[model samples]
Target: MFAEEQNPTTAVAGRRLSDQQAVAQFRQVVSRVEPVAERFCKQETADRENFDCDIQIVVDTSMEGRNAYQTYNDAGKPVVGFTIPMIADARNPDELAFVLGHEMGHHIGQHSHKQQQQAVAGALILGALTAYGQASATAANPYRYTGNDQRDMQNSIELGAGVGQMAYSQTYELESDVIGTAITKAAGYDPVKGARFFARPEGKRTANGRLSFWGTHPPDEKRLATVLATIEGIEVSGGISRR
Candidate 1:
């Protein structure tokens, strides 16, 4: 996030660019990434009827944090949103490119839908177990089957669903990193330096193990390593040279 008094100049392609200049560069990055998204959709969804790559980029000035996310609109089209603070926080065009590519990776990988499916499956299993446990309890003591007991059972099922959703969140985050590295490289950006954004103190600070196993994202260190390895592998294979 950026404070109101923060400097307006940002680094872009090793040169300082004002906020307006940076925004223009960000738009150019979006333009380059759009074709990459289209190519991915063509390769991944050619068999499906009426499937087309539709990605919309939204800049929300009202947002408070340095964050970006991918989601589907009401029409099922993928949307990537960047907060003003996030844009302001980006030190260079490559940082913005990597962030945009990362969000695109989420859509390209269909992580949103896949994660929902995982959560639903987990919730169903948990709900079944809770039902079985409640039935067993009621069978052992018929007098225990009261309104409060039913409410508690419902609460347990909800809690199980929440836990289930979190269980796979970290997995999806890692997967996104892999895909995002490729996407950033394909867009002709230096994913390695872009990845260094995660190595910064603020980025490292966010990876605390408070939730550990239940965290929504893996530790920043792990993510940084994955990005480094992925980019190295790609280079070794002569995929794309570092920009």
Candidate 2:
């Protein structure tokens, strides 16, 4: 989707790629994102005594065709894992870099850890309320947390757990784009050219959209607009926010 010299640092995930090809794409993506990730987190990573994270990329078909995501190991090392699904066919390196950057942004912004903590806290608070009510007035159960209630609770926690966490995630996406733009540019890629695939056409939707309360990603237009603005700003200012 991009000229190598023109836009060298796009995320590369395509359909039905071989294992070796996928690894090659991943290495290229890491090479693109590493510098941006470092620029995004230099102050702490540069300080050996105060290092906050170590990022590792794990590629496995066993992930059953998932896109890139951030997971935290017990030691709290941030692990970005990707499945074969994101890239449906053979894709260029730029496509891979964007996905790689998105996953990196999850760690860079600390959203994964914060969301994990928020979900747990929300559930615990609700559980305590359920328990206290059960003991108080001989109320069989105030929280009939099953079936739809369970589903609704889950959705609420995911979508409405904390103030603007969802919005913050959206913002981080823009941040990642800016970082990705710079990183890709340095790695010899055009960030905007790579971002075209992310645009959602009218009437078309992802399967995840079929869910009742799928609140993970911003609507495509919203995400695209934000990313475009970030890229434009970077093109004009040359990486102002990170500093």
| Whole-model lDDT per candidate | 0.68, 0.58
For model 2, the superposed segments whose C-alpha errors exceed 4 Å read: 1-17, 43-49, 87-90, 120-175, 200-215, 240-243
Candidate 2, residues 141-232, lDDT tens digits: the string is 65654446445555555544563344356666666655555556656665565665454221233455532111343335544555566667
lDDT of 1 at 218: 32
Report the lDDT tens digits of candidate 1 across residue range 54-109: 78899867756556788888988889998766676677767777778778777867
How does candidate 2 fare on TM-score? 0.63
Question: Which RMSD does model 1 reach against the true structure?
Answer: 6.5
Which number leads on lDDT? 1
- Looking at model 1, residue 197 earns an lDDT score of 54
Model 2, residue 176: C-alpha shift (Å): 3.8
State in Å the error of residue 20, model 2: 3.0
